[model samples]
Target: MTSGPDPAEEHSADVAELLALVARQIDMRMPEIVREMRDLLASRIDDLGGDPQLVEMLQASIEGNVTTICHILANAIDLESLQPTTAAVEYAARLAQRDVPLSALTRAYYLGQSMFLRIGMDEAERLGVRDRVKIDVVRDIADVVHRYIDWILQLVTGVHEQERRRWWSTRAALNASIILKVLRGDSLPLRGFASETGYTLTQTHLGVMAWSDLDADDPARQHELDLLLRRLATAVHSPAPPLITVVDRSTAWAWFGGARLESDALARVEELVMAVPGVRVTLGEPGRDVGGFRRSHEQAAIARLVALSSPRYRDRTVVSYSDPQVALVQLLTKDSTTTATWVREVLGDYAAAGEHARVMRETVAAYYATDKNAVRAAERLGVHRNTVRQRVDKFEATLGARGVDPLQVALALRIYDDLILDGGDVLPS
Candidate 1:
């Protein structure tokens, strides 16, 4: 070297100096690179607030290398010589060691470039760059940017599926908790639960469903019913737990309960029942508390019976217990035989023969209406005082004289009228 530097040694020294210079430049640019990455990530994260999927994808991309990313960017900008700087090479090597995808890095690079271009475009315009140059840069940046966006979207979709599965698991657990409380007739402090579970508490909800069939022995039908119950639970929110019960297998008294259903929750439940082929479904009314839920379920059961008994009430997907006929049917069903017998005895043959039954029944109704005043009874019946007297006399005779006690007769007549009007198939004795 003292005589004359060896060619190989000289060349090696020059290469080392070039590599060191490149390393220094990369080190010097580290702050800017980190700042750019942070800004890009922040913007993307802000755009996807609380979106678990987007967060995961972005994280994956940041942990990846920039080789493929750099290649893609170079291709878009028509610059093939845009090799990775020392820092980028190091970053890629670290990511590869960690087993992260290089495509994720490419995605990050495009994202960073897009943000840079946006800021650069404004500065260039302020500095009065020519329109042609601005357009060319924008087009080049945009080409790569679109690819990056596509990559982000794809990554987000995958992440979303994963997040959805996680949320579904959480939801299933929450639902199970609520259902356990419901079975025990206990109320949940939903606000507290929501806070603990990190779920929105503003919208509270509940739902119910039921099923029935003629062939109770059909195992296939039972399996289908079980599947339907599971399907209903999942459809409302993914990975939901079963909230259904077969209250009475013989009568097909199946039921479901849950929270967070549509405003027309009952209708939605009925729609599910209707969709089930061959199986009869009855959707109960929607409600909040467990007690209210029980009432709604009872109503649905009554509605199903009414549908079976009367064609006029048939094929109704959602049977509201509030319907006049349905309510009457429920009332009669409470004590049908007793009610029928009472009706027959009160309005028997004698009362029907002389129209005394009608007069006395009307009189008693009016008396009760007027708080048991004979004067008011006569007035409302539009009959003479003695005419009302004659009718009362005939009623008393028919009711075995002892039964003519005005209070007793009045009570009986009232009960009879209620039973008959409510579709009790009973005639007066």
Candidate 2:
């Protein structure tokens, strides 16, 4: 032992000194390296790269991390003595606040670490150190970076999860969970949930689905929609504040308890709903008790689907389950292909996609809607009575060969209207 210096010790010291020199060189190029790292992370992680605010946070975090790693190599700092940078920790917390997936945050770190390791190795090689020295230095640098990432990742992951849990435990989030459970038809202790949400399940329920064409991730949009629902409840004279759950940033599901839009209030409610510039609302028919709660929400959901599918209702600010032929169309269009076939059989030539057939379908629909009064149908269609009579005669003559039932023909006409509204094939050839 006294006779010789240990070869392994000598190699380790050499690698350490070379790594320090390389780290200093890399430090000099920090701006370029930071740019490369930022580009790499942005290209790889959407949630990290998407928002300008998030991207700014990410840039700060990357700068802090890269600087820290350089200091670790050049100064021979003890890994255990290091703390995650404030920028890095704050970035992770911000991502959590926005409800970005934890896996995405963790993935950013691993990706950044890999890129950092590569930069270190490249710098070592560029220094023109001997092959053995380069290998040793690169290996040591890799170990240091791995340990640093592992340490920082643990801290950041913990921060993200803690923030997410804190966010989820907030009053609105808790209430949303309870409401979702009830909406899912879960057999919950109704009284407890009712008390917790300050909504009564025993009262009449008017379910509403409100949505807009906007980005779902914007908190401001969601807040606006929530305020809109509160204003709607006040307009409708609800006995209590409406219970609303944000279905997304752009959509909300609300229940107006103890309030039904009476005949007198219909005009006012419609006026208020239409005045809102960009939002669309679908209303379920009033139902009583828990059964009504589920039924009304289901009806609202169905109305939303049917409204979205129909060009007539698609742009309308308010679509109600009580609207003319909405329920009938919903029933018939449950099976579109079958409904198409039935319409073709019932209307015969009137189901054709040609303009002549289109007019016939419209005339017949108006005529049927107005109790088969040709005069009233003409008024509705903005056509002369004689024109209505002529179309009616043609319609009757076409269906006469099939010996159609009046009610069945009426239902088929409704489905055909929906098909045309959707701008799809009315019937297969």
Candidate 3:
């Protein structure tokens, strides 16, 4: 006759049965567990939520990890046989692509492990097993899961680091870094800088910024912009290929090297840009040497800002730092609301909306352009000289009894007509 089962064997059977029971319970609550885990991560981690694509990746990672943990418990899968799920590895690579810190990624894993462990212990307790068996079951679950995370994390860490290194080593990434250092005025050997960037800093440079109104992620549009810039560089007879750095998917900065851009060169650039729908460009004044390189880019940046801010220039393709009124407008728009109020104070009734205001602005602008000569101003506006004189007189009088600064009044009129008068509505008033 068979002897009664050994106590050790019986104890082992009890633990095994309890572990499987807990795993099954957790499996049934998989949806809840996964949802809670995702919600918890999103609330605690900035990188995990808010983007639809990132959220999709997050869901795949959570489901894969949770399902694998549940399966390991149910099947008593050997810990040595475990590997990181494909989704998990892919998710890590994606985070690397987005430049999320490895610390953030590793923190998520630890958080997930804690969450899984808590669920497992809660399930074991709800199974109503004896305290000894409950302890044994939880101990087994914890050991297996902790080991799994340790192993998977080691591999995932390698994957993340490898992907990050690979991403930043790409030509575009490398060039972008070098350009940023220059833009920041970091000290570097000028000869080495030219060698590394294939761009000479001592030459005259025309700073240009190009952007598109289309979808920011459209690769075709970016390609078109690149082609347009190269063509522009060729048209301007750049001694070297244009130095271009993509600022984003839709925007890029470029430099065309030359002695100086002829007046006709700008006209040609505009003509080429007009061929591409939805594309816009801004150009800075030609600058010499390193100081010119930085200053020209700064001017281009300011021109871009002014163009972007103005509804009038929203559809116009090309703007330049040297364009009439752009320099002053750029300065005044730094504090838009204050400038608007100042404009209102200076222009008085001329700042208000209407045809009368428009006519008054044209007359005054032409008058200023003609050096306050009413005859020439009338000729420019195609209006009677008396009409120009009368408008100018009224405009000056509206500047109030103390009389405003003529220069300030000039700036106010320019901004009002260019920026505030869009759609017949006054902005920042």
Candidate 4:
């Protein structure tokens, strides 16, 4: 009938077009925006007495935020209500997991919202979006984000609270006691205690000391620490339910008992499990019997020390005691302060060379571990023999002839682990 377009429909169409333009602008700069937001959010979190762990966590948050925004801008009309996106809920849960006070999260949200508005307004002018719809589009976007945040916080705080109650339960005490006594080398019957602890002593076991890298356990994060343990146990398909003890708000000690342990268990775990936000897992080699149980636990404890005491290693989510070099490192770094001194003394400027230092030290260690055979070392390290030979020669050149001795070489390896692999960060305060 050639009727004029309905004014309401035309207005809606204009709004959608404006939003789509804004979304496009965001899409073009999303990568840079993510980096900026991560840094900004990290700063805000720090100001709020929160110890943020891992750049990866912030990266995930930014990606999630981008996805939600894109979805809303594309389908604003079809969406009847604002729903908390997966990323939003996960963000709240992670904050709770890190024991970051709820205020920190809300404060960060406000800061983020303010930044978004500023950016949107600036982009609106730059993009020459129509004035009639510009303010409305920004408001709609804000509304979506605000509603998502509110719904997510309400939902996840409940999850955190439930987990908190579970952590504080008497059952938690029983689990901790049974596991702690064994770790302390008490003479408990493996079977009897196994029945009580949901751990199967007869099966091969892998011990894990799972915890956050923060300086102290924040009570708020204990629930997430608890959940991290449970999730790991399930991911690995343990023969029996895992045995876990909450050591504190930031730390958990766990063991997975399996009828047969996978040879690539550590690799599998690194690929599948450790990438989950905010937790570090120090793993012991698989073993059996009560002795294996205790040994693996002790090894994992040593690996944790290596991981936490060095800033290089601190960033790593997984540390395995299975590697002979990692074990040797345990010997070198039994005392953190002393080992640090040794690394500085032995390697001199090279101790802090970062990745360069790791590659060289790894070459020498691989060489030594393979019985000083260059071909085998090359094979072991999966590098060309020439590369192995060159690194070894370079290592010797910097430290001189004495640096090549078996014992001296061993010390150098340990030093590298401390200064390079352990993240140069100081031990937790």
**Full ranking by TM-score:** 3, 2, 4, 1
TM-score of each: 0.34, 0.55, 0.56, 0.48
Candidate 1 lDDT over residue span 1-429, tens digit each:
358768777654543343334334333444554455655664653442244544444344443323234344333333344332344444444433322334555555566656544643443354344465446444544555465555544544344334433443444456556545544667667576445543322332233445555566654455456556655555444233334434444233333334444546445656676786655554455454546555655666677765554434555655555456676655654775676565566656532323545656776567667775667778888876677666656655766754645564555564554344334444221
Number of clashing residue pairs in every model?
Answer: 7, 0, 0, 12
- Runs of candidate 3 exceeding 4 Å displacement: 1-169, 389-400, 404-407, 423-429
The candidate 3 region of ten consecutive residues with least summed lDDT is 420-429
Better of 2 and 3 by lDDT: 3
lDDT of each: 0.50, 0.81, 0.81, 0.69
Between candidates 3 and 4, the TM-score winner: 3
Per-residue lDDT tens digits for candidate 3, residues 224-302, read 7877987888777787777778887788899888835678888888899999988899989889888888899998998
Q: For candidate 1, which ten residues in a row score worst on lDDT?
A: 198-207
Tell how far residue 131 is off in model 2, in angstroms.
88
Model 3 error, position 189 (Å):
1.9
Error at 184, model 3, angstroms = 1.1
lDDT of 4 at 79: 39
Candidate 2 Cα outliers beyond 4 Å, as residue runs:
1-169, 366-389, 422-429
Residues 77-165, candidate 4, lDDT per residue (tens digit)? Answer: 34346555566566665655444555666676667667766776676777565676777787777776676555555765676465445
